[model samples]
Target chain A: MMLLQATGLVAGYGRPVVGPVDIALHRGEVLGLAGPNGAGKSTLLAALAGSVRCFAGSILRAPGVALSWQTQRQPAVAGIPLNGRELLALTGAAPAGLPPWLASRLEERLDRLSGGQLQFLHLWACLQAPAEVILLDEPTNNLDPDGVAALAAAIAQRAAAGAGILLVSHDERFVTATCQRQVLLKGAAES
Target chain B: MNVELLFDPLFLWPCLTGMVFALLLPLCGAYLRLRGEWLAALSYAQMAAAGGLGAMALGWPLALGGPAAAFLAAGVKNVFEEAAESVRGAAYAMLLLAGWGVAVLLAANLPLAERLGHALSDGQLYFTDQGHFFAALGALAVALPALAGLSRPLLLSHFYPDFYRARGRSARRLHLAFDLLVAGVLALATTGIGVMAAFALVFIPPLAAAPWAGSWRRALVLGGGLGVFAHLLAFALALVLDQPYGPVLALLLVALGAGSALLAQGHSRIAK
Candidate 1:
């Protein structure tokens, strides 16, 4: 089922940074937006998340649909007393499906965890949220091999559970293995 | 020690008032610290003082002047919040200076305003009347439940900001409402506890407990508990030492802050 549809989308900050493009996300499917640096790949995700301004075009969501966005760069959380389990709870993401690698460390403060471990926890939270649409920007950054496998399995499970996911990532192999379709941009679309 | 004075009926209202402020300040302070706008406590307090003085100068009752000016300050910051599309912290610095400047100006022009200013700055907890005790009671009644309702979304707004924007909703409105609530509480706190003492209750407890909290609930617990503890201790010490409540409260918190900082150095929250 079509969960979200954007028609003739033109998205950007104040000026156009991406699109004059089109995309739609459907339940039970994973969509990949693949492109070079500055191709507005991240901007596209921001537009969909409604963080950046949308200059033109329209995004339509089916009634009562919810979304989760995992941004490309998270704000500094160091020295904050929040732990991984509490962080997950913010998104209403439970720990039931978290891989053992991260599950064992959920009790530790987020700042105390290593980079790859922290990255995986963030991904897991968004992937596991109750939202039907998940937008992930460079979700693979800082992730190790085991973390990647866990993420792949998670994506499959969430999609099977009727989620529609749109992700922007530079990890070509991860994208090829997980996404059934890829939309590639030839040149930089951010102006 | 003048510990007996704490139970004196003449001092009953002041002690009750002090205890009520102890509860109200830290609860609101936790959210202010969470939002990184702890300065709002001082800014709102100054604006209230300025508002009260401005009312005095114009022959208006303080009750009419203080909240009205604070409401304007909250509204101004809310407008800044919308224009900037950022958190309320962005506009607080400017508001702080403006409020202070207006207060100084108004205080210089009116002798009564000047006395009130001195009373506001030097601490008036010992002199808080029955009305002030009731005001503190009313503030506690209003602020505690409101802060509880605002906690979740504010936390989520900090951790997962896109959650609101994605739904085509803005956190600015949430911020404005919170600012107005905070302004009301801070105004009452300023009038009862004096500005420095009120600011201490609002800033110190939250900062001291922030590094120790493993969860949001724990953060609030530690912060609120610390606030009440330090406040009651300060109140007793001020009475015993024949010191003004404001400086004594500020000094005790500074002592607590020094202790907290030292303790944090040896502490580790990492699980095996």
Candidate 2:
């Protein structure tokens, strides 16, 4: 059975402007959502992950699907401060063991972490979620070469273990290295 | 009048310690709110204030004021705080009616008992006196331990998404716990009397700060600052107005909140 499915899903923030397209993710499948800026890449990921309300159509999913959105902005919680490990753990995906560099980096605040560190840790945390399906938005925004490589390796490992991975990214290198398939949203033509 | 009571070690301890705790609670709350837990903190603060007011009213000594007037204040705060988002539009109206009701009731019932009723109405019912100030300070002290206690859960929710997700612990629980505690303390402080003024403390300062406070820390600092300013201002205003001090203070806080909002808006627009 497909671990996740979104059929004719349409959603947006203020107005209904995003999608009515169909998407499906089977276990062990990794899909890269490719699109131009404002092409609803993040919005689509939000809808699929259940963070966003679907304007139309339906999203079917396994019971415990967890989404660790690489939100374009910083993550915040009221009255408390947090670092990388705490963020991942808050999202229900703290990796058991990190390569020493990552472990040391996690000790620092997420807001202060280098972009690359933030990107790598986001993916690493998502992969650890117990959910069958995971969604990430623009997961490669701040990654350096090494960070990109680590993310790719982590996604690959998780996919091999039968978790469905969905990500939106403008980084062609990241898409090619981590994703097995790509869905390009041809703007204006479909909208 | 009661110099010994004012300096009583027990009374002074809660008052002095409470100010310290009160000051820190918002800092922690601001941090949590910045991390995206404002809802939790707000909920807790509201509940705690309501319960505290009720307790204060119930425990109120007739010698200091009396129970009837105390309950009136608690009733107002309780009603004001519980109304949800949809009914928020009605807060001003509700608050006004509460004030009017208390005014009418006092005037009708205490026609012969002028000076005593007026003093009690001012002090016990409206938080206009030094005693109320001391009590508010003490409550703040109480909140310090509560803030420290809530920190771990709040931080875990912020940094450890997995922990939050797995535990399904929304800061709502924290808010509820806080609200209940505050309400109890407020009950004790007001003896059910100074609902309107207590309500002012909870809402006005934060509302006054929200527009200009770009972050939670800024908001909390602004709120706490406003709180102190309002209390001091109310004290001065009461002395000047020669009316019951608590109502006058509540009105002043509202005015200050409005002025702050206007100033913040103008400043933001000018900067833009």
Candidate 3:
């Protein structure tokens, strides 16, 4: 069944930065959104997440659908002091399938983690959340090879469990390997 | 040392009030520090001080004017939702300076202006009246549970507001509510303990506890405990050495904060 459908959706912060684009996400499908900088890849995700204003078109979600979004920028964790496990727990995300390296360091402070470590931990946080639709922006940024493999595995696991994922990434190899389908966002003017 | 003075009715209320302030202020402070808005406390406190002084000059109650001024200042920030960061910083600076300027100007005509200014800036906890005491108690009653209830969401908002928003939570409202609470607490505290003491109590203990804490919850608990200990210790030292309570307490809190930072450094080194 279709989990989320965006029909001729136009979205932006202001002045219509991206879209009039169409996309549909189905259960168990991984859709990759690939674009260059300023192509509104993040903006499109924001539209899906209901953060940006939709100037045109409609996004229809299945009844009672929950969404999880991981923005591109790593949240400022310097003073937060939350650990990986605590973060998952707070979001009601189960820690059962977290990568062993991350699972072992669940008690370590978020701020103390290496950039790659923190990135994957945050990705897991979104992936594990109980949601029908997941939106991840640049999920592979700062990730090492091992971390990327872990993430790809986790994504497959979530898809196997019937979750729909809308992933935005610039890494062609990761997207080619992970996503079942891909959508390319051109600059707003081009679109 | 006159030990009996500690048990005096005049001292009893201040001590009780101090304990209550210690409990709530550090919790608020830790959260503020987490949000990187620690300066909000000082800015709000100064606005409250100006309000109280202005009200006194106009023959109104200090309490009414103080919190009103603080709420107004906090509201101003909310109003300028789209203001740039530099603009917001400039606004805070201007509010603080203007508040202090108005306070000084108002006090100029009064005979005890210099002393009153000193009390507002340095604090005069022992001189707090019953009204101010009850106000602090009331603020504590409201702040403690409110903070406890909002702690998780507040923490989430501080670190990942976008995530909080994705969860269908209103991050902006949560921020405004937290800011209002801080402003209210500061307003009451400024009236009772003075701005200097309020700022110290709200900022120092939380900072002291942060380096040692593994989590935000632990930091708040540790900071609250540290605040209370500092308050009581300073009160005792004031009695022993015949010094004013506020300045001594502020100085001691700073000392404790420094000590904790050093201890945390040593602890980290040992672990490494």
Candidate 4:
């Protein structure tokens, strides 16, 4: 089941930042996008998510496909005065599957949570959402070892449930350990 | 203080109208503050007031022209917001200035419009009739369910703006719809309560409640409760003290904001 295919994609803010490359994601598989800083890995994800301009490319998604995207380093939701539980509800994710470490503190404000806990809770919302396609940008930024492992488990579970997942992160080990397939995006200059 | 006067037929309708806005406008305010588009309240209110004046000059009803112009302003604002996030504040300022400019020119030329403008500026809520009272209720009726239904996407958009566009949906339409609802509500409010009072209801109470609230739902209720408290207090204070409703309401809200800020600061300090 090919869920998404992007051919010769070139995306950027106003100019090409990434691609002239090809990638395909299938149901029940995690595809990792890796590169150094400024490699446009995030840009490629944005292009696929339609949040950025695609100068040239055709992205074909299977009929009735929907995307759930979690962007990099969102401003701390601490300022929002919402708790983890409220965030999950708003994102349409359930707490039933939450790890016990997180489930106990769902009532606390997001700002009160440590960085890794907050990041993990945010990641869980996207992972648990009922979307055919999931796009994650730097999901491992502040996660501790436990949080990272929890994320890896959730990713696998989501994949098993038939989502086509696109993962972008600088944590090479996490990516290498988690994704079934990997794509390296050379920066626009090298590409 | 002659409390019985508040229930007098003459004052009852306007008081009821204020109560309706007190409860409803804060919901719009919370979302506006969340979206960082609080300036839209002033933009929409001023534009609607200007539009009302323009309608009066043309010998037509002010209500129709007010919302019509607000919707138009919402379109213009949409263009600016779409261009970049950085310019949202600038767009709101521009809209406010344009409305102020047009309103000044219209008032200068039309004698009748000048009087109406003063009444609108003074926020003569006491003079509001049954029609104005019902309109406030009507705005409340439309805004509540609409805000409730739009809560998910609106909340998501605030948290992760890319969520909807990634799902291949135009986040702008949701924004514009919200803007239009605010504009309509503010338009009716501006006509009843005056610009500053209307904007106050949409600004201060939510602000006062946000700091203490533990959840989004609680903040909403607290904000509404605060708005009602302020409105009734301002209404009573104005009646007893012989002050005008608009200025009194605006002052009451400012006091609330400042008091809340002080308390929140003290709490933070105590925790430290």
Model 4 stretches astray by more than 4 angstroms? A76-78, A188-191, B1-3
Every candidate's DockQ is 0.57, 0.11, 0.63, 0.70
Query: Looking at model 4 chain B, which ten-residue stretch has the lowest summed lDDT?
Result: B79-88
**Fnat of all models, as shown:** 0.56, 0.04, 0.58, 0.71
lDDT of 2 at B51: 31
Q: For model 3, what share of native contacts is present?
A: 0.58
For residues A16-81, what per-residue lDDT tens digits would candidate 3 score against the true structure? Answer: 888879999999999999888988989988888888899889999999889988887667787565
Tens digit of per-residue lDDT, candidate 2, span B1-272: 33354434444333433233334333543543343323333333233333333333446544233223333433443454435644533543454454445444544555433333343334443332456556656655676677657655655544544434433455445544544444444434333234445555555666666665544345667877776666555544444444554687678878987898689669868876
Best by lDDT: 4
Candidate 4, residue B16: how far the Cα is off, in Å: 0.4
Chain A vs. true chain A, TM-score per candidate? 0.95, 0.82, 0.95, 0.95
Clashing residue pairs, backbone N/CA/C < 3 A, model 1: none
Candidate 1 off by > 4 Å: A187-191, B82-91, B268-272
List, residue by residue over B122-211, the lDDT tens digit for candidate 3. Answer: 777787667666878888889889998888787666555667788788877877898899999998888667888889999999988877
Residue A95 error, candidate 4, Å: 1.6
Tens-digit lDDT track for model 4 on A15-119? Answer: 889888699999999999988889899889888887788888798889998889888857546456788899988778888878899999999888878877888
B131-224 in candidate 4: lDDT tens per residue?
Answer: 9888888788888999999888888877777876776667889888888888888888888888889899999998999889988899999999
TM-score of each: 0.93, 0.54, 0.93, 0.95
DockQ of 3: 0.63
Q: How high is the TM-score of chain A in model 4?
A: 0.95
Residue-level lDDT tens digits of model 1 in B1-272: 77788777888789889888877787788877766678777888888878877888899987777777778888887776655424556577777788889888878887888899888766788888999999888888888888888876777787777765775666888888898998888777777887788889998887888778886678778888888888788888888878888998899998998888877875653333
Clashes of 1: 0
Selected candidate, larger lDDT, 2 vs 4: 4
Instruction: Answer with 1 or 2, whichever has the higher lDDT.
Output: 1
